[model samples]
Target: MKKIKLYRPIENFNKNCSYEILVNGKKMTDLKNGEEKVIGISNELGKLNLRAKIQWCGSEKLLISESNNIEVIKVTGNKFLNRQMPFAGGLFPLTGIVIFSGNSELFKNIGIGILILLLLGLIGTLTIWKSRWLKVIRE
Candidate 1:
């Protein structure tokens, strides 16, 4: 599997337009108008570019004609990286509350919500406690 970055140079691409990508003189499949990805392999080292219409934003995966032969390289934009959340010290408490408040009876007539809540609460508490104790011992 190889990673290749693709750039679109067209202005205002319509979602209904077809795009083409070629690799190593082999004509690749025409990308669907709403397609976000088209997989292709590179035999020579050059500008591996793609011509496609801009589809809707925020879609994660794209289907390519040569999906088996091509691997789509993920371009890590700032917007993508910024979505990661920092390790919160509140995970246990928040999860505990959620489990305790959620409808566990929905799982069955048996009241499993309390059990799940307790389990999550225990896990969260243990995690927080371990972290705090580790810090104290380190200090």
Candidate 2:
């Protein structure tokens, strides 16, 4: 038997949640932030496929070959379109609430708009671009 390590590092956006690790399209384990899980592989197993899924979002299917024999896989929540814009933008409305306490109405309206946009992004990720939500790479 051989061991494959699955590691999930603490990330800024999605660190609070745990993800389901899939081995050959089956739920193998739940990985949490900064946690590592050792998966056992049979010697007779020819090819191994690993993926991470949380709700409808997931990583690209990864195939492990006997030639490379990778033992460690790093997993994390991928940024939207690999950009940091949404993360920074998401904080602006929250900042406004504290900054403009006298004008709560204005900030409330702005927050609603931002929330809607964020919801749309979540919907897109859950449906159209589900595979891009998680990043899984061999280490």
Candidate 3:
């Protein structure tokens, strides 16, 4: 991922300022005034010089005005998942369990209810894993 270091020259305007980081004129994040501490971008965006603006200012240090048309620099780096293994070992056992359960006859004579329960559990686990991985990437 690329690392962009931005310095906001304006200070004491209020902690509640609405800041935006725009890459080549595209908006990335709309953060709370206080939340405007530091920002990072993915490597896909490459080295970018962004235009930032303080869109709003609120009462107290918690309230600050937005910045406009400010230029910032970005440094390029390796891809975010470059260090990830091509084959993740953690998914093997789960895959085996899913494949094994598809042949229901192996668990026959035990009762349809038991098989249904096992299938439901496997489905739930896969759903959770998928959602969790998606969340990690999104952040």
Name every residue pair that clashes in candidate 1.
none
* Backbone clash numbers for all candidates listed: 0, 0, 16
Task: Determine which window of 10 residues in candidate 2 has minimal summed lDDT.
Answer: 80-89
Instruction: Write one digit per residue (lDDT tens) for candidate 3, span 1-139.
Output: 4444444333233245545556545676654433323455554544444544443211111111133333233211112211242234445455456546666765443445454555665565345422221100111
**Tens digit per residue, CA lDDT, model 1, 58-93:** 122333343334444332212211222123333546
TM-score of each: 0.24, 0.65, 0.28
Colliding pairs, model 2:
none
The local lDDT score (0 to 100) that residue 22 gets in candidate 3 is 60
Judge candidate 1 against the unseen true structure and give its global Cα lDDT, from 0 to 1.
0.37
Query: What TM-score does model 3 achieve against the real structure?
Result: 0.28
- By TM-score, the better pick of 1 and 2 is 2
Best-performing candidate as measured by TM-score = 2
